[model samples]
Target chain A: MARGHPAGPTGPAIRRAFDLLDLFTTARPRLTLSQLARHGGVPLSTAHRLVAELVRWGALERDPDGSYHIGLRLWELGALAPRGQGLREIALPFLEDLSQISRENVQLAVREGAELVFVERIAGTGAVPVFTRVGGRFALTATGVGLVLLAHAPTEIQDDVLGGRIERYTERTVTDPARLRRMLADVRTNGFSISDRQVTTDSLSVGAPIHDHLGQVVAAVSLVVRHGTASPHTLAPLVRTSARAISHALARRR
Target chain B: MARGHPAGPTGPAIRRAFDLLDLFTTARPRLTLSQLARHGGVPLSTAHRLVAELVRWGALERDPDGSYHIGLRLWELGALAPRGQGLREIALPFLEDLSQISRENVQLAVREGAELVFVERIAGTGAVPVFTRVGGRFALTATGVGLVLLAHAPTEIQDDVLGGRIERYTERTVTDPARLRRMLADVRTNGFSISDRQVTTDSLSVGAPIHDHLGQVVAAVSLVVRHGTASPHTLAPLVRTSARAISHALARRR
Candidate 1:
């Protein structure tokens, strides 16, 4: 027998459920029933039934204000993702060491398909604030971690990003496809990437690739500092060393 | 029209989908199709269809060895959960400080219904191996963080746990309902709790409650050490101070 339907007719239902979940992103963490209905392209009554099931299963929770947000159960399941929590767990000690020693913002992120998602970020008390959140997505052409990940991404993803709209964060952000392409090549050659006053005028980040046992560039680690206080070159070796240490640790894990 | 089913009969089908997700726990992170079928008590064909849909939506991923594991997208969605990542983000700095200071295991957790779920845990280089995992659940009667959370839980949840089976972890684990009731009272009175060799024979933990702006115990922070290395008295004040700092930080977050 087939799974749900003998003729596989329930495909649309499963897609609709995913569509409902996809409607809840970082930009829209909470949604009202009507908002969910509108965004999911479903009628209010349909949205109501889906939301009820999601809430019961702990995929979503109702706030005191009656708005709905993602629940702890989803987060727990997410922690089992090898690319997300698994990578972060192995790299945490190294990231902590970098954060403590440099007293700067240390971030760990990985490429998921074409986009980059922050897996973990440790903010130093006095460090310059950079706009990044764990599980948050950002353009692949604008940040240090992004550049390293984009550089190591497959050819198609690189082409897709470089071939599309590259949003400029600051005057220093590389929006030109040709120049960004050169920068990615530089990352490959230099073994590190730098975003100097790119994402934000006050911040500069140095990033390096973290490889898995199979030698795949599974993630990137970075140290962001106040631009005027330190040069990217001075920070490159430190970030690279930490990334290597993380890679070594990951290689040892079963 | 109803959500998945315009006829309103798809409620059980949607719920069965979630029940499948719930079967993936920390102890059983990956499962074969047969295992999921058996655990979910669904027909093998139904399990396969649902699993395929979930995998297609990126809620689940197949390992290279053909086993299924939670996917990165689910982790990304989980990151939006306020009780999980939200609390972890706020408490990370203090947890880092505690870990650095004592070179021990520092953990932050929150109560979800009747169970305590670990949100963040930082292990010292020399710290003893801990059983807790990020996004993992444990009984509310065995560990320091659990004790602190259980003490502050609502009346009904407290009664339900007191009325339920209290699994024993070690000889020192307090399994008697009457004794646990007194311990909960003591936690409220003393502003902290201790679990000496409760979860493991060679570990000791001290935990303190972290309150929200509403003065509710929203989370708990704890430090676990080798049993003979530190006295609970010496650790109590530190844990309490850290918890208070986190509470104050949480209060400042709109």
Candidate 2:
């Protein structure tokens, strides 16, 4: 109730704290206090107090150079997320096996709204280079995993993705809604999706859906290789088998 | 201004929100609203409002069974943590190489206060089963990585760890402070540390420190194998090489 005591409506403070956290990203993982305050649209004094509290709670860490970063404690808490590490941990072995056999990049992803979040990725020996990173997000119309997720996604979500301006990463990227709809239909009919140089010029990926115990398509798995190195038809069954193995593992866990 | 609103001391509310988050751990990754209220020691109405805010911000998610879980957004945010995924991303390729070469469990860890947190782990085929999870915490006196981290830690931290109650996981675990002190000294002098069945009677681990550009030990890497299958002297050099490779990669990044 005291004035000028860093006391106010709890909602704004909590939102501001999270806003400060959101300023950190893959491109800019570290920031000074002044930068945080400026980017978060808060006063220096308020940012100072909030940063202190976050540091005390181990949500933020101060580096030796006087910059702030997301702390290890947050990583520990995030590891408990079922859609993230929980799913990755279950699928990692099968993915590793697939990557070993195919010697290509294998990825696990799940739908989040109109986009997809990569849960895990295993880079195989001498595999084609991909820009995807673990915990990163991508449009649901580019990558193989994204296509599989979008195909099985609810109708509203599919419409939202198709109706939005789709990013064209390469010339082969299908941005037309009619063509994409047919691609989704093929994915459903064949239980697999092929993204031929959709995300990159020299790479192709085949993806398959992972069903949970209730047979809901909760996640997707994919294998990416050099465009000319492997045939999509040959790779689809491998990716589909790996996805089924992961689905069975998930079903057994519950 | 307004009475009977959710307005309160922002500090207490922030602390209470984090407290609610802390209640969800590896053992209990999901909680109902009532359970969160009971465990977090808050009123049911307060918990409801806070949970709603958290869910709106994507910090928590509601499962179909009505349990709240840590959300994917937290995992995305946590990926920016320098001590957690940042370190792991740079060290993973080398850890994978070591895992392949040794055909044993490879682990990466960093010290947090008096404990060490596993940053990354690569499980090798047919290796001895170890009880370490990524983002999980462990003592600073048991595993090889723990000993290396404690040896390079500040003197105050070393004293705090040595002076506290050390856990004895197996009969082979050395609980004597004097002996542990000697082990720490050896780790500093030999550029590596070895734990002979300290955590598990069936396995042995060798660890080496990974330094930053400043030559300060920032993390540790380890390899674990089944007891009597290999010599620690042979494994020490491999782990030390992998650690140095990772440290060099880290230094090159900045």
Candidate 3:
């Protein structure tokens, strides 16, 4: 390890570099050098040096206008993530089928710590607007895919989520740990999950777990539609079928 | 920059970290610590420290089998890349429309340096087998999208590519600098590109440029079919229309 003069405020060079990268989000996808320095909480000189290093490695790109954004090399590296782009590639065809047949929003997600990250999303004809985005994170206690993943997560993860504060997105969201536990039990028993206006009052979602070769729940697939347009019970089988297809594909690949 | 002892092999910490990340690819998505050390040409001890730092920053994940894979955090960050996932999100609907109508492979790509990286690819009905993968790089002189991007590239970049060694995939691939230059000129004049068995003998691709708000060629979209299945002239207008729709969408978004 390099144990000498650190460039940034306090952390190691790697930490500072990631801190700077974390500053870029959907709302602020592009940032100038000063904005990066201010948002990353580093000195301007340090920020400049770190940004130059990141640009050199193609982790970040400098536009002609002098602003910086995440680079293609990082995107290529990220495509190797098994739970992210890798899973999406194997499941996208099935997701497209579900989207076309159901004409509703299709989503795939995996549990990460106490939260769930959306791996892929396909907008269907007349699809309801969804708050979830590909690669975005959400609470494990809400959303159909999240509930399925939370249901199959390890004991520690379940406890961490249920035992902590549950964020309520709508009035229908179940915040009680006892009720949430019961819902999880039902998910395991029924092999599917439903979020009836839990995320948005105007929408309902049906989700099912996708298992790996070891029979562990590795991910969840879901379909979101307008609340009154479709019943969750009617949508459950369609979502479950797609989920099983993805599970089989994953097993074959593994 | 941290101006002290370089962690490994005399490079900065950021370079070493990215060099390690570049080791993960489609074939080798997962690696052991020893593999990382060996592939990255770093000392075992230095690899351990750097890997730990990366893991702490959520750039790498350690699997249960004692292997490391690209982490979800990196994927989330990569989603912010304007030339990668950002462009894909905007152009996907148009690409899907083209795919649904053509019932053939549809691809989206953008220029990075002298090469083009595939941003998205939708497999179509009875789609011919294509060698291109999403996030994979290809020569700017071979594929349909590559030609569209190269035709609009700066003079320096064109000269750099024309002056360098060109890899040939099939006997019909245009390799001579003079011939390649004429093909590029025709692409600009005709407002589209046709790659006739340049990459693979069994495939034919038609491409059109997607312009940004400034009307500059920021990306390219293409329709690829099996050789003799569809004439390039018949497919050119469909691809150009979809590309124009995507360009309009992008312009409106800006």
Candidate 4:
């Protein structure tokens, strides 16, 4: 949060570099140097110099059109994230099995601070559309995976989220803190979470926790189906079993 | 190439930070601060300060074990890379179709400089075992997709690769420049590339190019099967058709 403080240990130049990289997103993957300068709040010359350095370092790639894009090198580095590709690779087969049997949307997610990040998602054909993108973030109070992760999260993170205003996506979303608190307790007691049309109007998701070798809940797995097509009772068992299998696989691999 | 000049436009501190991040690989995803300092060629104090800033910025994550690893933020950024997850997501359904029909390994790769980076790979159960990893790099001369990418790459890149020492993975790997040039020409002429026991002794791969809206070969897709079980002649049409479908989908999506 330091803006141009010359005395901080975090060098201003590195912070500026981070600013440039942060400007890139799924929506704006390609940007001209002028756009980078405007969005990054840096001068055109500064942006030019920083972009040149990033291109040389293989962090940002310059296209034939003279626009910049997130490069393959950054993706290669991101592949080393234990909670990203590492976890996704181990859980993929099990996630595929869940998707095959249920023929619905299957997702794997991990809590990042007070929010949730989707690691991987597989959409089953003819299934209800779910607006989930891989490596995208969602609020921790809405979907099934988000609810499960929030339930098992540390108290501080939970408190921060619970005390803050929760965004309601649909009429069925539970935004009341007291009721949401009880929902968390029930998720703990029932060993799974069923978010009935909480994230979207027609999709219901069943999520279960995936534990680590130390028995800590490291991630959550979920299956999203049409609200009337499948019962949460049946889907929960399949998701729970798959999550357990993936947890065991993770443990054995390590 | 700018090793340790303090007067360069690219700050040495930022470069050192990149060096620290570059150390984490699939083989070693986590490292202590001491290891980072040693590998990054920075003083312990400098490494500690830089790491603290990176962790605060969510570029690096500090685990409960006190080891640092690539963070979810980086993966989110990587999901923006058009040649990485963006290409993979667009090509996944086709890759799945290829996997289901042939029951063989499916791969997608793009040229990175003179080398090749595997963007995505789907292994067919009980099929040939492959060493390719998603987000992993490989020699451009030893795999089917690699050959297709090399064939379509710029002339300077091809010359650079041909001029360098080509590491042979198996007896079938083409290391001779004249022979490799002929192979590249053949790939361009035939609309596909066949690596007969080039990457591994027991496996063979057939690859075809996927073009963008501009008719440029943006990526390559392949199917790897157990050698001698299925002929590349049979797999070529299947692979090429899938690649075409993906190319069409990419064009339509934009």
C-alpha displacement of A48 in model 3, angstroms?
Answer: 0.5
Q: Model-by-model lDDT, in order?
A: 0.88, 0.92, 0.93, 0.91
lDDT of 2 by residue, A145-196 (tens): 9999999999999999899899999999999999999999999999999999
Checking candidate 1 for backbone clashes, the offending pairs are A46-B3, A78-B75
Error of 3 at A198 (Å): 1.4
Model-by-model DockQ, in order: 0.63, 0.78, 0.81, 0.72
CA error at residue A245 for candidate 2, angstroms: 1.6
- Model 1 lDDT at residue A169: 79
Per-candidate clash tally:
2, 0, 0, 0
DockQ winner = 3
Candidate 4 C-alpha error for residue A71, in Å: 0.5
Chain A TM-scores of all predicted models:
0.91, 0.94, 0.93, 0.94
Candidate 3 DockQ, CA atoms: 0.81
What TM-score would chain B receive for each of the candidates shown?
A: 0.89, 0.94, 0.95, 0.94
Best to worst by DockQ, what's the order?
Answer: 3, 2, 4, 1
Candidate of highest lDDT: 3
**In what order do the candidates fall by lDDT, top score first?**
3, 2, 4, 1
Query: Where is the poorest 10-residue window by lDDT in model 3 chain B?
Result: B1-10
lDDT of 4 by residue, A1-254 (tens): 65564543434677789889999987888999999999987879778988888888889998888999999999999888888999999999899888999889999999999999999999897898878889899999989999899999999999999999899999999999999999999999999999999888888999999999999999999999998997999888899999999999999987
Model 1 Cα shift for residue B64 (angstroms): 4.6
Colliding pairs, model 4: none
Interface RMSD of 1: 1.3
Quick one: RMSD of model 4?
4.3
